[model samples]
Target: MSENLFVKWTILPQEPPQPLLYCKRCGGTRNFRSSGKIRVNANGKRVDAWLVYKCMSCDGTWNRPVLERQSVRSIDPLLLASLCANDAKLADRLAFDVEGLRRWAPHLKEASNAVVARELLSETPARPLELRILCVVPCHMALRLDRLLADELRIPRSRIHALEKSGALVVFPSASRALRKPVRDGTKLLIRPPAEDADWIARSAAYGDDCP
Candidate 1:
């Protein structure tokens, strides 16, 4: 049996989704920006919370509900305090919550286009390297797997296509158009490098280093 090596890579998408809403003050649809403020209200034993957003053009305020009426005692005091204090980190994280934003604004635009950070998480050494790629998307975005690999591996796109054609690279849940498709989490790629490039590929796999 051929030796099997394993390497794990993680891809993190870095960008926040923007809310597209109709600004009453502006009299047209415009993007809204996160105000980093949480509005909280308490009535008897119940509490309500909302994430505040403001129209970019007119600064009109819109409240995105974070929580409906609920028992105050059931909520974490620290989280409640963070909401009252307008925690920047919490607000920033919520800015990426596209699903939440969609409830308030039917059409939301992304503040920035998706960019990725590639990280080599782990590797088990052996003769042939089977790479496991985990893609963590904070928002709804699409990027081709081939381009990502080409850039991360410092290899040419044609080389990747050629390898796939020759059976040197095998994608799990294999799709004929896998390379062109958007990458999803838990995708596995098994690579059996050709004899000519085995040593170079092995070195790259061992170090998880991009070509210089």
Candidate 2:
């Protein structure tokens, strides 16, 4: 109806995905979390490294290989040093690797928990009629797009669906089942509401303190 009020939402997943593996002590499959420890072994010119994982149920441990007898010459010295020193950031990044976690277990119990950092990318209007949200994900997280919007807007997913049904909410640059699936980078949403509802939704989208 007017120049869109553009806003950016940066989402960061809080927890890493847990790999479910059978634990003999627990007598069943259990989730394993990263121990934030790295083990490196160097034999001649070959190097092997792993990120340690611990079973949540029994304190049992598993090692996820980061390097497999790689040639020292082929590896970056900095990366090798980080692996040896047990760099927390490097370990966290590796631990959050959902695709890599698939090696141990095809299915993972991924956390939907995340924090959204919002910013206004365009000028605010006195009576805003349109709001566009741009989702920015630094790393892959398992949070659904609708869940994210509901969380930030402080509303129920059912309300979001209602808006969609009324043609007030439009999700673009997305495929089918976008709402049910995990949020991805560059996902955009356009919201157009009646004049009376525009101000409230805009404030909520921008996280205004006065929002209902």
Candidate 3:
């Protein structure tokens, strides 16, 4: 491989997955979004905590239990304090917990849309260089790797497949077909575009730019 140009792409899912639940007010199954709040109740030696969710249709509320009737002594002090304070980070993490939400309902609706923030590591080289991208994902997302690349690069998924087949684009952990899989944290992609196409791909990977 020649000298490489690097870019870090952080993929953040726009919203947490919504669990479809029977809404009493709506009289039907409705999607619930996180209210970004925590509800805590203290009853003598026991404590209860829930991450609050609200119905998208009618604003009906649901308390997704974080913990139920657990002794305060068993709880970590920092966690308990953060829950009491309704810490934004903690709430966000809870909201993205699709597995946790599954305990209450099996049906889930997830937003595949994401915000991709890219930071270019080096200037364009005199010669075409290997374009390396590190995918930094903070939470769960429904978007596929191929879909993301196609959208960001303004190229069709078929183009990506062609590149992979011709050995121009290399995705890490060759054991799996990650191109079609959900975008994951810490996945690395290396693009060795032919000299003719290298410059355009580098620019597109770093920002939203139309190639000449």
Candidate with best TM-score: 2
Judge candidate 1 against the unseen true structure and give its global Cα lDDT, from 0 to 1.
Answer: 0.70
| Cα RMSD for predicted model 2 | 2.4
Question: Model 1, range 109-134, lDDT digits (tens) per residue?
Answer: 65433355555555444454444445
Candidate 1 to truth, TM: 0.70
TM-score winner between 1 and 2, please give it: 2
Model 3 alpha-carbon miss at residue 5, Å: 1.6
Off by over 4 Å in 3: 119-124, 175-177, 207-212
Question: How accurate locally is residue 125 in candidate 2, as Cα lDDT from 0 to 100?
Answer: 79
lDDT by residue (tens digit), candidate 2, 1-212: 34668889888888998988887777778999999999999999999999998899898988888999999999999999899899999999999888887886786888799877889888777778788999898777889888887877776899888888788888887577677789988889999876766777788888645453
Which residue pairs in candidate 1 collide?
A: none
Q: Write the per-residue lDDT of candidate 3 for residues 1-212, one digit (tens) a residue.
A: 34678889998888889999999988898999999999999999999999999999999998999989999999999999999999999999998887788898788887799888888777656565788889998877789999999988778899999998898899985646879998888889999888887777877887755333
Off by over 4 Å in 1: 1-5, 56-59, 110-130, 136-140, 156-159, 193-212
Question: All models: lDDT?
Answer: 0.70, 0.85, 0.87
| Better candidate by TM-score, 1 or 3 | 3
Provide the lowest-lDDT 10-residue window in model 2. 203-212
Clashes of 1: 0
